[model samples]
Target: MTAWLSVIGIGEDGLDGLSSAARTLLGQAELIIGGERHLAMVPDDGRERLCWPRPLKAAIPEILARRGRRVAVLATGDPMCYGVGARLSRVVSADEMTIIPALSAFSLAAARMAWSLPDIETVTLHGRPAEMIIPCLYPGARILALTADGGTPGTVARILCEQGYPDSRMSVVEQMGGPAERRIDGIARDWPDGRAAELNTLAVECIAAPGTVAHPRLPGLPDDVFLHDGQLTKREVRAATLALLAPLPAQRLWDVGAGAGSIAIEWLRSHPNNKAVAIERAPERCALIARNAAALGAPLLEVVEGSAPQALAGLGAPDAVFIGGGIGAEGLVDTCWRALPPGGRLVANVVTVEGEKTVFECHQRLGGSLTRIAVCRGEAVGPYTGWKPLMPVTQWAAVKP
Candidate 1:
């Protein structure tokens, strides 16, 4: 098919910033589709114009309907970098569309700050939660964030302070590539209410305050980081469970009977693209799971408040499954086992004798490895420190052939 759709990337400089090819396509287009701000850049020409509808995906059919005709869709910066082009490409084939390039916000922000693009972590807060920035808040890290609106900078600053990086340097570069380009700088702890421009990119130079505790994106997070009511996986056991589960990029995990959602959250923290769903029976624990997910920068973690086996219905098949509780629940393990595709992993940890028997039976039938993990911590006994043993855990891990 001839490329009838032209997805052009435009910067804040508007028409002046567009390439000759992008401009010619826009001039020849019969229908122009974009946000009101982007549409305003072009004077009312003879072409039919469309402002993006509520829930942007609603306009997909309209774009598809005019498939053979000249259609130009305007987007900010590089359309592939967290823009509408990526979403539209899923439905519109590359052969039918020509994607034009422009300087992305990240590129502009890095230039203004004199920072190396490859060294910084770039994320989008546009239509996403602020907590998504939490996982990227380590000391000496550089981040470039595309803000949702004017209020995002303050929210980012608040999160920085709460996460023990109060002394971090913050810079908001407003209206990049435009004549009104401006930069505002401040420390995260003392970030003022100087409302940033709507079209702005936030840059952060993460500097830890004195005595700030570092929480690296590793499997073994301290148990206290999660809010739990005794129905929690201890730190060491949780780490062991994650090690067996083996998180990878863009892989999804099903955390069955997620108590305080530690395992699922840790799985998400391991990689930005990793996804997890926490299934819990209690309503209060479900709410706590959400809190933990948001606090730990895994706001994308889905919390299903119901018992397993039935709740697992309609959920997308996972790359890995971790059964932390409900080992005695009928058909729960079987349901999870059957859902795995070839090479999928399943790990179950149980502390009780009845649960251990079930795991043992599963190992005998499934032909996988079994592991027993016992942890002991030192505690004060009068003037002496003695090792106190916690409940031992029996784990069964299998890879579907």
Candidate 2:
């Protein structure tokens, strides 16, 4: 039988916040494991203390391999709530562990601001990048972000400002649930100086202009919203293409040749749980995709700055796939089709004749639906009206056999 591991959640209040049961567990722990802050909480009376290595994932297995040890792992707040508990739980069986959770910083911050947690989106940048929070932002969306450090709030503020949401209200909750608990409220436009804390969580209230483009809930958002280099599929056509791809929740998507990331962004938008790895060769286009994703609340689009076929390796399999660009007469379609699992959908869109022919040939061999989409818009050429024909898009969609 594997020895039990006790994962305990502690707050800045230290032993004061600990329950009698938790304190007893700490006292009896033969091996106490925690971050520096957490280790300081327990009375240092000869219990073997271990600090986690730089990459926590690399350290977990070695620590767990030590058998017959009464190990106590300390985390901040609730162990399962954006804490280390969830990651540890994945590696260890439930039968081999007990979790003692305390008040989470999220709860404390929300309570301090009198905000209900269910109504708000919680993002943690503690050990992650600030960019991860971009996808969760929506007009009127309330956010509780566990900032990486003092620098994160500024980075978040800058990103929000750049995304045309400069007026969004933010409250910095520092040392939450502790004696030095402080809250600083201000608009993102005029972020207060010296208001940031190394250990703080931010409460953001997104405020967007009326009639601003509402966040799309589906993959393949209208193309007009993106600033593309004439290398993007238009809105209606993109939507149709995405439908053919058939994205599923929590599925990974390999968006090869993700020009402007229209297809990839839309894939992620389809389901908050869905993820996409967009491979685009152009640096400018990659940057554009990041900006568009950040602005539209789909910032989780993992942009890979490389061309497809060569870049496909080391990228894991996808449940669905979209090839929006770089589909030539040879190799591209075959590679993507081979990567799909049974029941997986592959949709490729092409505007150029050369690319269209390639798509047609792939459709012929793969046995899927093929269609050409022509989109035109009304423009006032003279006085009354004129119809302008945008270039047609040829699409091929196939399900893996």
Candidate 3:
């Protein structure tokens, strides 16, 4: 058994809360690895101790070298639940490791609140910005968020006020499973963020204030919700593009020429596992992409600043790719077509005549449907309402064979 590694979950109470099996395994550990906080739990164990190195993902090789030795990793709550165990598991062989789980903080928090775990949503603001919680702010929703530090509650509180959830009730539950464990309750508008301790988890009982129109978490989010500089993919067309892209579980997308990052944002909003990378040439647009993604709850969207083809290099092949601009650029479409694997979807939209010609020529050779989307909205013309035609968009979409 010493030849395989054992990753153990220890709580705030440290060794006192561990099971007999976990205690025995930890006792025999020839080498232990954990953060400074978790390391303080065990005293004079008479074993070699190694602090978890910085950039933990990059430290995998050093960890794997200790394999076949009596090695133990101390983790918080459940190691598989957004802990280092999951990170290392991606690089280390599963055959050489065993994971022992403890009760998760979410489980404990839900239990304390008497809220059913399945009925409530759980997210971790751990090492994440509070703006990333926007997608979960709809009325009547309950959320258990793991906070990074004492300041996280304040940040969350401010975000709620801006997002029209000022009346949402909050619970700052501190140091769960420890002697210091306690819950401080208040509304988002009056949250005593500074009063809460560092090691805390926040539970939200969402109740949108009166007349605070909520941004419904759906494919067709209204255009006004995003802070764009007039250059936007119209709401109706954006919805159609997302439907054509067909976001699926665990799929990744490349949003090339991501003017306002609407497509990528919607793709991420579709599912938690869904991922996207926004590539834009203009620095201003890239900035918008980051802010829009964070504000809309997909902060994980990677924004790379550079034109396509050059920027697309070294990027992981995407499950789907959307070209929202620069359709007339030479070799841009060809590179995207070749980069996609079989069954991968590629969709591009254009408005200019030159851009349409490019897409039409590609359709003739590649054989995808060419569609001209023309939308007309009601407008006041002197006396009565009249139909106002907007710029027509030509869209071409195909799957790699």
Candidate 4:
């Protein structure tokens, strides 16, 4: 007997903000689940109450157990907007739950600031690194950040100042849609008044410093941004490899023999939903991979330290697999190929004759496109400018049937 799950969205005004039907629903609820703050607002209806368990996920079993009963979950604003509803939907069937949404905090904040929600970038610093906002800090950018607590404003100020966007405007709009609503405004560089409410949102208007270099959102960030030990894929090859890899939303990649993790980093940068795992053998290279991933705004990238194919054990299936190093490792191609489901992509790049032979054999067996990439840049050749060619790379790319 599966219980019906009703997710009711509430705002800072609590029960007053809900409709008559919503209030009646709460009054009739047999079991109520919500955060401590939201649960406090209920009119002492004497319903069985449960605070969301630590980790939230651990409590899913109990929640599921209450199925087919008058079970109701309370959330703030739109439950679907960076709220528990999104997480629950992934585990629960759509028919099992009914989501009753209220105006989201993002929308309320936008109304307060008179900023169009669609025109501004929306992010949540709630349980996220402030550094993750790196990709959004271009001059003249508008962002609305859902903050976790008071410290988020200071963290935002420091990150913006570091990136030369010190003069950026920050409005800490707290307790929106309630009698305690307040707005604190300041610039990022001089964010001196750190006073903030426990429940607040950070709205930003970026103003970069004169000399600040804004990193663009694209594959192949500048090679100098990474900490590598001469083992990284060059900017040219990395860009080309990423193009061939073709990252899509919700896709995962496995960067086999990930040297400096440039491929994985760029793949992640392509889209927020994109995921990747960097498999590297060298201890130093693994450390470098972590550094580049964090600095470049893809901290979620998984770095597996050990050589393949032994290191590749128990890896999540990937939508794409790239072999940038250790192309000569035995059983590497076969293992990667067997791991990929149909429609998955595989690309390998090699500079040596032996490595080229391995790719060729795979191409023959697997049926993909093979090409030799010969890249050259102008160099001063004995007082005369001429094309200086770097070592040509043979690339084999294929998609699984």
CA lDDT for candidate 4 = 0.88
Per-candidate local distance difference test: 0.92, 0.82, 0.86, 0.88
TM-scores across all candidates? 0.96, 0.89, 0.93, 0.95
Tens-place lDDT digits, model 4, residues 281-390: 99989999998887777878999999888898998899999999998888999999999989999999999999999999999999999998998989999989999898
lDDT of 3 by residue, 69-108 (tens): 7888999999998898898788767877878888888988
For residues 57-110, what per-residue lDDT tens digits would candidate 1 score against the true structure? Answer: 899988888989999999999999999899999999999999998999999999
Candidate 3 displacement at residue 56 in angstroms? 1.9
Q: Candidate 2: lDDT of 49? A: 89
Clash pairs detected, candidate 4: 2-67, 2-68, 3-67, 3-68, 3-69
Whole-model alpha-carbon lDDT for candidate 1: 0.92
Best by TM-score: 1
Better of 1 and 3 by TM-score: 1
TM-score of 4: 0.95
Q: Please write out the lDDT profile of model 2 over residues 154-246, one tens digit for every residue.
A: 888887776667889988988887788787888888886553778999988988755556554665556677888887878888778777877
